[model samples]
Structures are given as C-alpha cells and as structure tokens.
Target: MGEKPGQYLLWNELRGDWCNYDIVGEQYHGVAIYGLLPDDWSREGFETQRMFELVPEPANPHDRWAISVRADGKTVGYIPRQDCQSWANVVRRVAASGLIAMVPGRIYARDAKNWDEWDGENDPPREFASTVQIKLGDPDGALPINNPPTVPYTMIPRSAIVQVTKEDEHTDALLKFVPGSGYGTLFVTLHESVSGRAASAKPVVEVRINDERIGQLTPQMSQRFLPMIRHLASRGLVTACWGDIKGSAVAAEVRIDGIKANEADEVVLDGEPVTLPALIDKQDDPETYALPGWIDMAVQTGARHSYESQPESTTSSTPAAPPLPPAAWYDDPQNHRMFRYWDGLRWTEHVAPKVR
Candidate 1:
C-alpha cells in the first residue's frame, strides 16, 4: 500500500474541551470538542461515532486557514491552527469544488465517580471532562501500492468525454518505431505553461505513452479534472490512468472511457488491464447519480477563488503556542504489558493492564 499521510491529533484547550478521556481501551487521533454532557457524562457516549464536516473559514481575521469541525450544523471546535496549515489545501480544494468533506467523530469522556478501584492514586477532577476525537488522514491512502497513492475523486454522474487533439506527429513517430500493432498503452500527465497563453488558461492533462506525449484532453475535460489534479499535486503524487492509444498516423485517438479516479489504482499499480463498468446515466439512476442541490447552487452562484490575493495585515499579533496533547492511555515506551497514562504534561505512574 502507499505510504499513508499519517494521522494527526488536534488538541487545543482554548477552542475545545479538555482531553480527559476515561477509557484505557479506546484510542483516537483527533480534536477534543466541548459539547453536551450528561450529569454522569463519563460512563455514557463513549465510542459512538457521529459524522462531522470540516468547513474552511478563509475569512477568519486571525487565521486564513481556520477549519471548523461541525456536526448537524452545530460548530464543535476548530482544527488547531498549526494542524490547519497542513490540511488547508485539501479542505480548500474540496470546498472550492463544491463538495463537503465529512469524517467520523467520537466523544471520549471520564466519570471519576465510577472508578471501581477507589485507591484514587491519580484522581481526576470531580467535574466531568468530555473530548471529541475525529481522526484525520488522506482520503485515498489505501491504494496503488506506490510511494504516494493515486489521485482521489468524488463521483459525478458520468465521466467527462475528452477528445485527444494534436496527435498526428506523435502517432507517426510511434507507428514508425512499433510498426505492426498501430496501438499503444497510454497514461495521463498534467502540464502547466504560461508561455503564449492567456493568463487564465488552466493546466492541461496530456495523454502519453512511455514519456512520449501522444495528445491532450480537451479544455473542458481538463477543467473537470483540475480539482483532483491539484489535490494530488500538493501531495507529490500524480493523477494516473491506464488508457489506450489507438488508430494510426492518419487518425490517432486516446481513450480512457468511463474509468473513475478511484479505480485507477489497480491499473497504475499492477499494470492490469482496466475494465471499467458501464456509465450510469442521470436519467436512469437519478437517486444515485444526480448532482446535489448544493453543487447546482454553487455553479450558479460561483465560489471565491481557493487562494486569496490580498496582502497580509500589517497588524502584528503573537502566534499562539501549540497546546499540549490531551492526556490519555498510551502504549508503554518501556514495553510493559500494561499501558501508561500520559497526564498531558508527562508520563505518570498511573498504568492500566491491557484489555480487549
């Protein structure tokens, strides 16, 4: 599998709840949010995951990359500023593409009242402390088996039809080198150029075979792919596909058919022949393939550019120091059978035996 982007923990006390996690068995890498708590908050609501959205707040005067975690339209807390910088590109691109990013969020809390072992050596505060942990990772980290995974995609009703143009010379060269077949395998690569082009010309996706450029996807098709391409570019990866370069010097053609980005892994990783399923028409499967209402509204209303062009404010403000990670049961650094409790500041004597 591809190297994962690595999970990160967001625990800023100022914006969310204290990480006073009660259980020794459960573990999470996420933010701790302040939310409703029962009178006996500790014993309830542990491990029940809820879906939450990560919404970008580019206009927040203090930080342009502020990302708020929300559930059912209620704001839980912000992704810590430091961590937001790492996630800004992905979140911004998804938002700009008119899609919502959702992840599972779980609540962790401790009720000291129910500690069966009343020794009270490492007594937690009497007041209830609840934490919300929402794990974060690359959307497509489990595919391709390369250093970096293939580009990620959200499905649309149908794949964009792109005709590859300007392939006459390239096709002639290929036909000369590999005479009889009159066909070759193709892959996708994107190129950016500012020379002799309009300022607004977007990057172009080229169809290639063995480093030789065969043709290019049409402008409209490139636009449809820009969002996914940009996201993969940011992670030092490329959008890839296994396609066919057919026809001869007279008329060359590149065809990817209905291959989705998610399915590119098998083709790119194993060199397996790609077999795409039939396209689902919006009319035939409106419930499954129809464009969402928000997307329609976004296309009509238009969204602000993903990046701001304004200069940074002259007003100087002190950057907040990163907060300590929430206290929780962690694997013993010394390889003990029991888990050690980290008290936010340092590892303490408190330990709990491992339990399934």
Candidate 2:
C-alpha cells in the first residue's frame, strides 16, 4: 500500500491461499519467474484473447503475483499493477481454486509495435524488458464463458507424463488393480457411496480401482480437483474420476499414485481461484469465519486473515468425513444434468445425473 514495498504479506481468503504483494510504478515494478515468448510476439503483433496467468512468487516472501502474460503461443510480459486486482477478482469467483490459477483471459495492444522487448530470463532479456510497455486492457481477451456449445472445449493433458507408482499401501489393500511390482496406470475414479444410511450420511469421493475402494483423496484436494475434472469431462478429454491425494493426513497415511508437484492437475485433470476460495455452505453448516492476524491500520477492523473449513474432520478414519449429512443426491451447481452430494457440511466429489 505504500512505497511499492518489497513483497509483503498479503493474504487472500478466497482461494484459501496467501502470497506476498508489491506494487509497480504507473505502476509496474519487479518481476516473477519469466516465461519466454515466440520471437514473433514482437512480430505477428498482440491480438485479442492473448492469455495471462496469475503466478504466485511464494519464494519471494512477498507473495507477489506476476500476472503471467502470453501471446501468440508465447508467454510475453505481465499485467501492470493498476490492472491486476480487477481482472484477478473476475476470474476468481467462477473458478474453484479461486486464485486465478489458469482460466482463459486476454489482453490487447494499441501503441506498441515491437518484436524483441520483453524481460524474460532468456539471454538479452534486459534489452527486451526495458523496451516493453503494458497498459490496462491492452490486448484484452474474452473473460471465461460457460462451456458454450459452439465454442469447442477439449482437454490437453496438464503433464505430458504421469508416472504412478504401484507400491502404495492401498494398492496392496485393494489387490485388484495394483501393479504386481512395476509401475502402471492405476485407473482410479471419483466415487460416491449411497450404500450406507441415506438420511444420516453423505459419502465423499473414494479413489477406487477395479471394485475395491482402497482409499480416497483428502476433502480439500477432492474439492479443488472436482471442478477441473468435470470441466474436462464435459470436453471429453479426461476419462478418469477426479481424484487427488493430498491436503490432509490421508495424504500422509495412504499410499496412492504419487504426483511430483503440489496441487497439480493430474488429468482426471486440470486447476486456484483468488480470495481464499469462497467456501460454500448452506444455512446449517456455515463454517466459523475466524481470523488469526491483526490489521495494520485503525480503519481496517476485524480479522486480518481467514481459513477454509477444516481440511479434515474428526471422524476422518472412516470412509466418510465427520458428521456426515443426510445422504441424498443434491443438485450440482456446476452442472445441471448431474447432482453433487451435499454431505451436510460440504460437497463431496461425487456427482451423478438426476436421471442416472
């Protein structure tokens, strides 16, 4: 808020993630991990639908979001400070992670006509970086739209290679699909159970291969992952159930196929939104909105930071999360034909069509 200070603590509650912040001059200052663009980024000229990414610089200790800008098949520059917040919010609301992680947005170009001025980490980046100038809405791209029928959507595997290890503990527990010793594709699905008490419980997504349910991803991991998988399924790109095993003790105790990085879209596949991801709760299970930090100024009152509903519940040992809600197929807000399970307190990764 002052002096474009070096990256400072700036917490966002919507995506349920925090990062450092620093302002730029005009104001554009500093930079983030650089991505190189095609030489023609300065050649073919910037156009409509040029994409951008909100990359968090966690190592900076200043939580700076370098609005990664891309054009003509290359990641160009970044969004200048004045425009970042507004666009970031627009992308956050609709996305599950709520961090502007990677929804499609664009920027346009008006005054600049250059071919080599971008500050990528590549050699001679400073020469290009110094010549670069970005203004608000320049090379603007369309905001995210619903899965429009006319506009085709398809899945491009987030990772070219996904290596799943079969030596997992659950792989042994479920004996049906695990590789005998070597690694193989352990096809898992996002599962929901209607087998138990109907009204008294709602089941979460279990990671199952063959017929046996060996284990499940953590609640938070499942929640973050479900939307992306659904979006891909809608496009017919992803065929596996949306499943990830992280964000809780289940991540530590259970052995599922391992992903190399954190919060990766392992293709059942693909997605953070900004403002700690707004937790969705109905009238009955509103999570306690508690804050643990302090405000720097007198005018800024109330809690300084917030957290999402506990990632894990008390009775987490069993198949269901604690205090399971009445088990019934509830409406899936993301899709009309399918319904999500409102397990009382939270939405489970499970979804089925009302007709199904």
Candidate number achieving the greatest lDDT relative to the actual structure? 1
- The deviation in Å at residue 92 for candidate 2 is 27
Model 2 score (lDDT)? 0.29
Angstrom error of the Cα, residue 95, model 2: value is 25
Model 1, range 1-356, lDDT digits (tens) per residue?
11111112221111112222222111121112323333443454443444455656655666766666654433455677667766664454444433445554566555335365456777733433345666554322211111111333111111333566666657654454232345533334443322225867656666555445666766666555555556555655554543444565566566543223332232222222212111111122112232222321110111111112222221122112222333443445443344454555776775444322
Candidate with best TM-score: 1
Q: Candidate 1: which stretches are off by over 4 Å?
A: 1-45, 112-126, 139-356
In model 1, the clashing pairs are none
Off by over 4 Å in 2: 1-69, 78-188, 191-206, 209-212, 216-241, 247-356
TM-score of each: 0.30, 0.22
- Residues 1-356 of candidate 2 have per-residue lDDT tens digits of 11111111111111101112222321021111112223345432443331233332212222232343322212234455565544443322222222223323333222332337555554532111212332232111222111112222221212212222322556445443322222222234433432237675534345554445566555444453455545555555422321222222222222332222222333213321111122212122111222112101111011111122212221111111112222333335455454454443576685543321
